[model samples]
Target: MNHFTICASKNDTHDIEEGILDTLAQGFVVEKNDSSYLLKSKGLFKRHQGAIHVIADNTDPDYFAKNMPGMMSFYHNIPFEDEQLKELVMIQISVFNTVIAVEMDKEITDEQMQLLIKLLSSIGGVGFLPDGTLLDQQGLVIVYPNGESGPSNFRPHACTKMINVQEATSAQGEARKNNTIAFLVEKGIPYVASLPQLPSVEDCAFKRQEDIAKRAVALLIAIQFACDVAQSGNIEDSREFFLNMLHKYNVQQFLTDNEKSFLQAQYPDAQYPDAQEAVSIAWQYEAYWTLIWALGFVETLEFPDDVCDCDYAIQVVSSCETFEQFYAQIAMRSKEEILDEADKIYRLHWACVNSRINGQAAPLALNESVVMERRRALFWMIGYRNEQWDTMSMDT
Candidate 1:
């Protein structure tokens, strides 16, 4: 059986019916594929296929492009009754799924994008729960370093298997004593398992990147909501709402610098750039940023500061056709491999340049503009992941 069921509460059933009708009005038609569900949205540029799945007892369009390895997004259109819950559900789903977002007509700032990367990176490998808690593969609750203590706290209930005792023989011995399966656990501070035999404290970096992308998408959705509210003549209220949202939802603390910039841009006397111009730039630029961030393999691999020069970064990322392709090539595969398979290839491609720094060989000669063009290609790749490439490339 699927993890989620289609049945809803009596009150929600009515909303679901209305949502289905509205979706049909917008050209969505549901059809079953094998044992899965498909909702096809036929438009001029491309026919969007939404793979419907009910996860965590919520239904979403588990999105995929014509060709891609990992799942990209989970979409849902909300009815007016519970829009906030719908929004929260989508955000939580995206966070757990590890989606990478590209640019579109949506207005999302580069500053906001950076914050998303930070938020996801903080989660390490495991994605956050809806309320910002961490969970393991078996649905066991792990400790949240920054989370609040709750009356309905499930952590203690789920951590029945955890064994923590002071005055243990050895540090490694204490870590091994836990009867639970987790990469990391906390005694006083966090303790990471040793290789296959021990529990670990840190999350995997590549997984962290996925969380970053998901949070970015959530931020964009929030920006869209704020813009809609602003359009309704509640500009001050909207702005305040957005401010509060960043404070509450941004668990990774990614918004401090971006929030400051956003407010500065909004002030009457502030040198606010053109809103239209900023929106246009943010949509495409954010996608480009995601691609470059992807190249770092987030938690998996770490690059030296000098390696991030725009030209070199573009060269490293553009060599692959898809994000999955890029990750496959550059990632490292070992017992405790941090990098993805694709990232390893890019590392090898740039081996000579890195060798010079490591005192082995001279750097390769590469063009600046050529590298930037490749970076642009990565933006295009991310668009494909979002199924937005059809805006220019195909017609349904």
Candidate 2:
């Protein structure tokens, strides 16, 4: 069919029809004829026609079983909270009880597409383009069953792709390496100016800036509390303090299992953290340092050859009492800047691993632990592998 189609709840048929007519009436003279609407643009020779067809008393079983699964899989790649994602799924399910198909006669103009999007938002509808691309109610791209998406005018792809880091001599890999070296040199980090790059910002799917900012704030609070628990050694008081901080920031759900384990060790009945645990948790300072830099709290992230300045790291977060206060201070670095750093760090981490395997000194004074920790943070920022914090793979 050479037209645009959208599916919404049958319950919204009246509002959908009324909304489309009212909106089109502003630019096109609209007339109702039975179930169809005919339109003629004012002061122009253009004309268009459309109709709303409601499929009553039944849901599209194929839509629920086939399409929703892929869409839900796509949502898993997004970094939103579980509850938020669940709510989005529920909204789509509600609209599926009875379907209303909206068909437009002419090729959808950008203006008309936007109008459709508004209608979808009003009733939690889903859209299907002639080219087979799917759109959620918010007009965000959701992939089809085969991992393909439509409407080339929208985002280039609906899913993120993994870069083969080992294929350094391949076409994309070569280009990435060249770009990485140039970016690092331009930004004044020239130590690894000779390393190969993995992927650029445009090559990867990134979380929204607002979401990343919130994640950074939550991470900073969690890490700071973890550090305090490590230092105090008083299990009872530190556990209360750490839990209070998590509640205060409303970030109880953001802690990874590793963080939870470390915190749990501080419980009165649990095994007390040994010297080794303290040292390991202290290394999280480097990760926290990277987060602050990404959030623009620090203007620069110095070379990761040594431990980060702990006192300064604590002070930066301690100054912000509320989550909103801390979030307000964030002027997140650009995607290009963050991706460049991630690329550089990824290569540095490989070098560190290679050195250890070969029983040689780490190249360019690189500290394997520091580089690994910073790489984890950078990779998370760029949505590398889309893995959770503790489970993030650091494959060289």
Number of the predicted model whose lDDT against the real structure is largest: 2
> How far off is residue 354 in model 2, in Å?
1.7
lDDT of each: 0.32, 0.61
C-alpha RMSD between model 1 and the true structure: 24.1
- Score every model by TM-score: 0.21, 0.51
How big is the positional error of residue 260 in model 2, measured in Å on the Cα after superposition? 2.6
Residue 319 of model 1 has an lDDT of 55
Clashes of 1: 29
Question: What does candidate 2 score on TM?
Answer: 0.51
Q: Write the per-residue lDDT of candidate 1 for residues 21-85, one digit (tens) a residue.
A: 34433454656444334555555554444443322212332332221111111113112233443
Poorest 10 consecutive residues of model 1 by lDDT? 66-75
- Cα error, residue 379 of model 1, in Å, equals 10
Q: Candidate 1: what lDDT?
A: 0.32
Clashing residue pairs found in predicted model 2? 133-150, 177-197
